[model samples]
Target: MIIKRYRVKSMNEAITRIKYELGREAVIISQRKVRKKGFLGFFSKKILEVTAAVNDPEEKNKYENSSTDSVENFKKVVNDKIRNQKRQSDFNYAQSVNLRSENNEALLKEVHQMKNMLDDMSKKSYDSLGKSKLELKLENMDINKKVIENIMNKVKEIQQDVEEKKKLKMVIGNMIKVEDKVLENAVVLVGPTGVGKTTTIAKIAGKMSLIEKKKVGLITIDTYRIGAVEQLRTYADIMNIPFKVVLNIKDMEKAIDSMKNCDIILIDTTGRSSKNKMQLSELRAFIDRINTKNIHLVISCTTKNRDIDTIVNGYKELNYNNVIITKLDETSTYGSILNIIDAAGKPVSFVTTGQNVPEDIEVMNSQKLTELVLGEDIIC
Candidate 1:
């Protein structure tokens, strides 16, 4: 039987390495407990050691015996090879321990260490004729462990970076403060399809009419959707506000002409997907017709960062003034916010938390945004 001793940082790493090197049939001979390190920032890590034994000797006899040997002779050859293997394995194990004791941590990262030691011991083994070659075996170990260590460190750094990203996502998500927002008496909510643009319009309209006591006029350029008119019509009806439905820029001009006397005109646009360039051009025409007092880009907080970039890029031709971050109540990943503000280069104006008419709207606060990013309690 052969015996070998291996040391590793953890018991799991050690056992996994042992199973990988020797087959599962290998038996452990002994184990030792490592002492703790002393003072001076020194505590020898609690290292564990295990000794394993394996069968050998059958291999040598197999080589010597004839091909037509009887069962008894074959059995003897198998046993001799097994014994020879066991003895060579033990000698290699002893040499590894002696070399390791000479202060060589170069082969100590668990798996690489075993491979290096095995490579040094394997090139000049006994010949197939059961005779020693006595050739040089330890001349060329071409492995550069330093490169491997560098790669391992880089992998660890990437893992830590991913962890930090996940933590930042949790810290700042769904937590923007909605203070009282100052309006220019007019605001345009622009975004891609299904981003709650019209509902956001109604939310702002309800707030303006009920809270600010402004005579809010609702304008819709959304004659495209089947119930787009009805949706705004329903919200305007609930708020007792006047509503206008315009199909094109000429119609928008007429609607503006009709509602020029109103205190605040909230324009509900067609929820065209940002990829539809033709519709975006049409909307650009409508926006250019009116004097931009408060051109706000309404965006969903739940959308991916790339999609937000696409939306921002598609809308940049219109030169919208500020941003409204909507659907904050639906998501918990806020990395998109940094991408939007930094990459899109747009300042945020308001935040919407829910579908409730007026109650869900909130004005943006910079300090509160910082606090949310830090996961700190909001200072009242």
Candidate 2:
């Protein structure tokens, strides 16, 4: 084996050098962070030190040839032994053939009986295997007990030939629901802080204004957080839509009246801790004044199922009718999405997979949600 050490400014550079010089088969022996040379190391920069090894090609070739020769010799010996045994067996079988002819009827009957037994056993094993696989998939999904039971029962009602993934998709599609129409006038986005409410609002605003070519208006009641107003205002300016920040019911009413002629008005709300009843109540007061049918509860896909339950319940006063699950790309498991919607019994409106303003957002669909929950490979 040949070993070499590489020191570089970053791990990525070290890895690149190792791969380029040592080939893909090279193994990393050790790695560590080290400081560059400097006077007493006072102002030196940190760097990566990596030790890698690759087998010498000459030695590797020799070993491969030796193993290949041994395998060939073994195969030759086995084949000779088998040929000798076959000649002896054939001679012995010739002597027994006449005697076995008298018992052929009984032997055939026994063979038929054995084949029947094996067929029965195979059928039982196949059914057991399918059930076990289905159970394992459902167990890993972290679905609610009742939901799982319902799905299992539904699956039982399907044809046995249906694929497991198709059955799962059917069950999930029945459980997951999406809004029937695009969001319209006075859509208020509410959620806990750090849940991407502002970003979600911008995504929705951009989609309506840019894609649909609708006359969109942005109204933010998120004046509490520093830069909150500026963030939405910036997005509004980019989208070239009318924007307003209202502090009171009077101001909110005036903003709404000013943008009444617009196709749709997207409202951005200040995110508050769900535990803060006073803040929730204050938010509720503002939403009550809006008197709009479209109140979307924005929640992150990364949030814990328990915290999501609490957040949804806490924001009940807002009476959000729709849900927009954001940050789907950040989380691998989507059971929380099902858990949240199932617990809240609300339909999903839109889903955001990433931070890309309009491109990452999609109108929620039941089949897509099912694919996400069960994993993408399940369908493909």
Candidate 3:
């Protein structure tokens, strides 16, 4: 027998519906209750509770049959819900997969277009160069292997965009890492005046002393300048490193001899103007006396583009190992770097950004210089 309780506005209506659905033998009327919730609630609404039960043998057999049927019914309801969910999920998955395929195809097409455009550009430049070379050869009737090579190389270089130019710069520059062979015990800073040469020395000297815990010494070949030695002396005083005054090539020779035991000996140049060839020659003489592996050429980036060629031309006589561009924070344009790189036939060593001692200067390896030169176009 099955009994059920129900709440409704009218017990008679509920009982009538139950009897019709379950049959008179199945639904046996049990009890009723009238609810009252104060005067207002009672007057506003009517509510009643009804109870019913099943007692007939036919009804009992039907109930027993339904008990097993109930399980199957529940399973069917669950299966229907799962089927609906699976269908929705499959539809969503198919939509997503189709969208992804479309996006991939579009990306492939775009890449193909870019490649075609690049090939067309290359062909156009090569054809133009070939035509020009032919005209020049026929007009002049001069055939030199070097001249032909130069023409071809110029043509290739002209075909490159900003990103391609950066790669070419790296290949041409062959910029070396500063840390690749860190000179221990001694270093010499040689460059023209106003290129932040003294400050660069101080930066590296302080870094060696404070961070590397190496016993460092400072030597100055800037005796001609009024406060060059004093300025370096002051920085040395602050850092508590030994500072020595160099009078000539002889003095530099002896200074290195005396500081042979020191971990790092940073030599400061007079920051002599490269405009005066004599001054650069005098500094080169002093550098020749020292047995240093690398000589860093300090050049400020804020300088005018035209001045880059002049400065580099003046310093080329010394055959300095690398260029160190300084004052990057002070300039916006860097096209001069390209001009210098092309002319000097040398690579960059370090780049100094600010006036903060030791902390502001950094080694200008290939990647950083490429990014700074190429701006937004070079792939990160």
Q: Top TM-score: which candidate number?
A: 2
**lDDT at residue 60 of model 1 (Cα atoms):** 30
Worst 10 residues of 3 by lDDT: 138-147
lDDT of each candidate versus the true structure? 0.67, 0.83, 0.69
- 322 in model 1: Cα distance from truth in Å? 0.7
Clashes of 2: 0
What does the lDDT read for residue 208 in candidate 1? 82
Question: What TM-score do all the candidates reach, one by one?
Answer: 0.52, 0.62, 0.54
Pairs in steric clash, model 2: none
Model 2 misplaced stretches (Cα beyond 4 Å):
1-133, 144-146, 156-164, 377-380
Clash count of each predicted structure? 18, 0, 4
Over 32-69, each residue of candidate 2 has an lDDT whose tens digit, in order, gives: 98887769666777778999999889878876787788
For model 1, residues 80-189, the per-residue Cα lDDT tens digits are 88889888888888887777765366535655777776565463254554322221110111112232233223434453545533433333332232334477455687
Better of 1 and 2 by TM-score: 2
lDDT of 1 at 85: 86
